[model samples]
Target: MTERRHDREFVRTFFTSPTAVEGEDDSAKMLRRAADLRGLEAPDVWVPDNEDATAPSMREEGAENVAEVVADSGADFPGEIHPRVVWHRDDPAARYRGFQQMLTVADPDRGAVDHIDGFVIPEVGDIDDWKKADEALTLVETEHGLDRGSLAMSVIVESGEAELAMRHLREEVGKPTNSLERLFLLVDGEVDYTKDMRATTPTGELPPWPELRHNTSRGASAAGLIAVDGPYDDIRDVEGYRERMEANRAKGMTGIWSLTPGQVVEANTAPLPPETGRWLLSAGDRRVELDDRDGAWAYDGDRLSLDETGDDYRLRVGGDERRLDAEQLREELLGLVEYVPSMSDVVDSMEEFEAARESGTGAIAIERAATLRLDGVDVEISSDRMWDEATYQAAMTPIRLFQDVYDHRPDQREELEERYGEDVVERATTVG
Candidate 1:
């Protein structure tokens, strides 16, 4: 059985520091590494391809490690910033009110710090204190100017009231507040809260957080929550990381963080699937519909581009740009036995399979109720494929052109194939 399955599908990641500690500008380079681990890169808006993104430019550990994230995507750093120096509280940018900030990604056209879409901060002292934390968050939600329906916001919950923040996220997002995408709690340290306590009490229980966000939107993820803390959890004692991930999932969380990109495959994928569908696509009479969308293609027959998200590709199966329905989800699980060698890789490869559903547009029965309000059809994606669902989620993570924009360079892709094996992709299907 594949091990690391999840239920929630629609998700994205946000990288930020709890507080901009003294002389800590060099920290944000961690986000760049985070994107790479998931087989992803920063959007073009944050960093253009022509620019040199060598490792040296990264913010090094210093008295104040000022980190910078530059990007490309026609989206400029909303404020003035440079990659060379760290932005401390004294920097004039902190004085402003209600301003959403981005990191300056490297750029060929300019010399200033290139920026990526990131929340800026003068400093933060605690995560558990919503009383004080709410001030910046309220401003962040309103000032972000993000489309309420299509985006997720990361709320750093660590102060004593961190659990309260998580519960608030479940009810407040996509409702009256309509400001959040998911509740990914970033625990700054290995403070043990193993058992549900008064503080780390899970969200959505009898005693819910203040102002529940009852109203949801289309194309939104169910209130998937997560916990990420610990350093090098992979190489050392991964069991603890797994325990935390599963614990959070039990508490209605969707995903967790990995110490390295290599672990992302395992961290994201479920190491197990139901033994019944152990080797075949059918999940107890369900359709395991697999399509060949792996190779380079384009929408409107014009060749896929960095800007365009996706186009309906009518393959052997039905078409609507692309697809990865319940059936395909089943097949990915079934194929795991044939292609996936270990439990960890089985979990890692789940990302590709999950990404397929995002290529096409559909009204999944599970999605109908939680995210899209489409309970019109009956749906059941059994827990048989544990590798597919986040314990807290019941839908699929859609493919975003934001992610498909960049094709891995040949050598790098070859390295992926070498690492995971040719079978990592679909069988008998041609891929890059």
Candidate 2:
């Protein structure tokens, strides 16, 4: 398996704050504020945006602000820093202007070289365009006597051609001539892509473009890079942002563009496993949260019937009726209601199974039993889930993600310790 790049791990949130705003005494006020963020509000990757977020007239000041603010405060910042630079494949003047801005920020005399990780190039075209961007960064590195391949390059996939160029990444990366190895992230920019495609919608809102997201994930996986979704324009729609993050998570894309610090907090927490466990009961076209009523999982919903047979229990849903034993009833109920495990629940189960495996047991069966009271009808149910080496490894994903978060966000350490408790926080951060 290709290991993830050392500098880029667990990018749950990508925040782009404007670099320089007019009329401010300090042009870098916004960038400085982002650099000072701590706890959950801090993003995994912070971009001092000089491209779209900064006005055309203020871009030069913005670059200077990025260099100055990052140089002054980058050491205290907990997240990775990458400034977005202006670039367009067909526009040479814009590309050179971007190049000049990159050189300005990357200059060792600016005192920001050590603090800067890389640059985010926007409006790239095909593979050649990518190579040109990479070559430009390479030249910038050499111009400053910085180490080759030291500056990472992340691009915004804004056009159809840029999207298609992703297929050549794995192959292009193997060639030793260029600094393709410095490529770190593949971020989607659906707004520009929509414009590029001339796509129209009745709602005047961006299409979900799930296929682009999936393609980005696949390409990132293929190239061993991180894939980030575009910005959620509706900043106040926290729930909507969460729903998109959830869907993106299912597609292997964890990081998303956060428009505000509040959005950053939501994005940061969205990828981690839930803090508490719950059961979600689903029937065709309907779903509801199943509550635990004093040691008995109870349901007060309509359209479900429970009846007792001499030696079995029968459950009728819609038009289907099935007879089941106690364990079978539990399994059936579980099949209908999925359990979303919390961080603690996952850890407990993994440790238990690990102990069993160490005690000479090749596999262990986990029992999940509960008393059901639907419409005041009491029916006891029980089921078993077998766990072995493969299952144990699967359970380690959340633990690994937890460790990554704990490792990267030292600013959030105390909060994490308090939320998960010291013991759990310790085991979670240290466990494989």
Q: Which candidate achieves the best TM-score against the true structure? A: 2
Q: What is the C-alpha RMSD of each candidate to the true structure, in Å?
A: 18.4, 2.4
Task: Encode model 2's per-residue lDDT on 1-432: one tens digit a residue.
Answer: 456765556688889988899988887789978998988999888999999999999999999999999899998889899999999999999999999999999999989989899999999999999999999998899999999889999999999999999999989985887778888989999999999989989999998889899999898988889999999999999889999998998898989999899999899887777777777777656777778888766777766777877888888877788888877877777678767887887888887887887799989988766676766767666667888899988788667777888877888888787777888887676554
Residue 49 Cα positional deviation in candidate 2, in Å, after optimal superposition: 0.7
lDDT of 2: 0.87
Supply every candidate's count of residue pairs whose N, Cα or C atoms clash at under 3 angstroms: 82, 0
| Clashing pairs in model 2, backbone N/Cα/C closer than 3 A | none
User: What are the runs in model 1 whose C-alpha is more than 4 Å off?
Assistant: 1-67, 71-152, 168-171, 175-235, 243-254, 260-424, 427-432
**What would the TM-scores of all predictions be?**
0.36, 0.93
Worst 10 residues of 2 by lDDT: 1-10
Q: Each model's C-alpha lDDT?
A: 0.29, 0.87
- Give the lDDT of residue 89 in candidate 2: 95
Candidate 1 lDDT over residue span 133-228, tens digit each: 333344433444432222222333223334344444445544443334332233322222221234453552233221111111110123443333
